[model samples]
Target: MKFALSLLVGAAAAQCGKRSPSYLTWTADSFIEHGVEKNFHYTQATLYLGYEAAYELTGDEKYAEWYRNQIDDAVVLEDGTIKDWDYEFYSLDDYRIGNNFLWWYERTGEEKYRKAADIIREQINRHPRNQAGGFWHRRPVYPNQMWLDGIFMADTFYAKWTKMFDNDNTTAWDDILKQFVLIDSHTRNHTTGLLAHGYDESKTAVWADPVTVNRDSGSAPLVWDRAVGWYFIALLEAIQLFPESHEGHSILVGFYKDLAAALKKAQHKSGGWWLIMSEPYPGMEGNYIESSASAMFTYGWLKGIKLGLISKGEYYKAAKKGYKLLTNRFVRADDECLLNWEGTVEVGSLCCNGTYEYYISIPLQTNDYKGVGPFMLASYEWETY
Candidate 1:
């Protein structure tokens, strides 16, 4: 379960330049060689997504095989239950890796993958929800709250699970859309169109404002870029599985388009987003361009355009600009030609009033899977579409 904290030396192409498929291959190979860990967590789960995208784009069995090996070795147990996950903790973050379970199930039609995935589905059915029916991000910790990031973690898998195993369950589709609708109504700023990172529905969190803060109602104080990025990617992923004729599809599309326009406008001159996405605090020294959110937006814009949810010209320009900056600014090639992704904010949360200082103070990391995974996805989307 150990990861090489330092960059690994390896032979590969030595460029982190524009729009080449080799970059994607190099990135994936570097990660696989780094050794996928056995621990079940969002960072690794996020990277699994990049691997999934790589497999899809290149048809390389290595990418798929790497993922399959990790799941078999690290995730599922002898009795078809999952390991390294606690049933007592109803955290949405834990639900993410289940997407890999679903993917493996579809690939092999194996009962073990299905059994593992059902464990997550069972948790989702029983997970506590706020009065409005939106999930609490985590029980006991962050109670009575929902975060923009939570939707991506839980509902994307929920939508895919329903589609795969319970397509006839009409209520599940309605519930999926309700999460989006509630988060939008509660957190979105009508003027800026960006969502706050999290919302405390009971208005009990220290960060939840009693009144509008920067025009966003009662949600966590600021628009942390990666938080919004999570919601953005989730929308694209979930909508594809959503039945188009369902009434909720248009609702989700409307939410997606609004955020898309907001993100397009928020793009920094450098083709990235600030760590703090709300109005820049005057004299804040630590605010800088973040890598993961930039990569996520790049992936979202490109994927959205490919899905016909957004138009090509404007978003394509934004995606291309972001991808180029993503490569030149954050992604690097070491002496061994192994790709390194840098400048990802370690974490941002609703603690400490979700303050400007708090968001800026989080440490930056290199090869953090959160950033690495999205960078891989962005690179794949850039090359393929």
Candidate 2:
């Protein structure tokens, strides 16, 4: 069945005008249009990262222009301050769009972009952390907890800031590395070699495992595909910014290799990953292949292979299968050129004991930024390959 799906995808690619279909091209426009209609937020910020990748791959000004306009709209004050941004909330999610500021600064040498990024850097400088030194996912609400999602939300941008602007500050490197190491130490399930969705240092969240606190630590119950997906992609992004001679660089590479191995094992025969990745045993209810996470893993694998962080053969094959499954099974297009990528869970969080039911209960959404962003990113990487 998987082989047949791969062949269909290959046929689709060949029949399209280019090596790949026009999904990324059309979807990029769709996402940008949606953002224009709605206010720009962190979600749109993330989608722009994928669009930025598309811009790099094709050098299309439309993609670049869309990103610039989105950033411009978000950070509108003459003084280069972000409009309507709430610094007091200290939510890691709010900081993701700062990545675009950094991107623009590097591209255009614009001081305004740098000034805008500084706002996020100041937030990170004062953001609270757990007992083990991992940043809290959010202030006041998710205290003493570190969600995998926050790693990408804050650290990727933080790492870039350190590399680009504060290279002389050696302690920034340590601060950056500590989050990954601490999170992995607390969250990883040694038996499965996969980390859980989140960890509560206080062991107080209803979702945190009481027994795990006594046995290991207070980690959440399930291995969520998108949470791990965030971690995987963040590791790759962070590694690029680390100095090769730094000990932290080796630590990150080790983590990435370990995660790549675990994900390689966890990938479904369908060439995708399950929403509850570790729960894929026969007939496990709600254990189904998810599109956004699948796209994220595909992007990570292909990018990892390209960067030589992992060996190519099996990782490349798995990536190929994932890209094929993504393009064939999930992606759809209409006559109006609207693109929809199906099977994305709109929102998943570690709330109320983190039960299996809780993981599956999140409503599925189509054309969601989480799904669309990774799909664009995966498409760009696949095209490059």
Best-fitting candidate, scored by TM-score? 1
lDDT, candidate 1, equals: 0.83
Runs in model 1 with CA error above 4 Å?
Answer: 1-21, 213-217
**Cα lDDT tens digits for candidate 2, 99-200:** 888889999987888888898899898899987678999888899999889999999899999999888687999989999988888788777778889889
Residue ranges of candidate 2 with Cα displaced over 4 Å: 1-22, 33-40, 280-283
lDDT of 2 at 227: 95
lDDT score of residue 362 within candidate 1: 80
How do the residues 1-385 of candidate 1 rate in per-residue lDDT, one tens digit apiece?
Answer: 0111222211223343323336677789988776767666888889988888889888999888778878885788767888866888899988988888888889998888899889999999999999889998998888889999899899999999999988878899999999999888888888899888888888887888856643434588688899999999999988888998898888888899999999998998878887778875422567778889999998999989998989998788888888877766776667656677778889888756788877777888888999999888888888888
The TM-score of predicted model 2 comes to 0.92
Candidate 2: Cα lDDT at 174: 92
The estimated TM-scores of all candidates read 0.93, 0.92
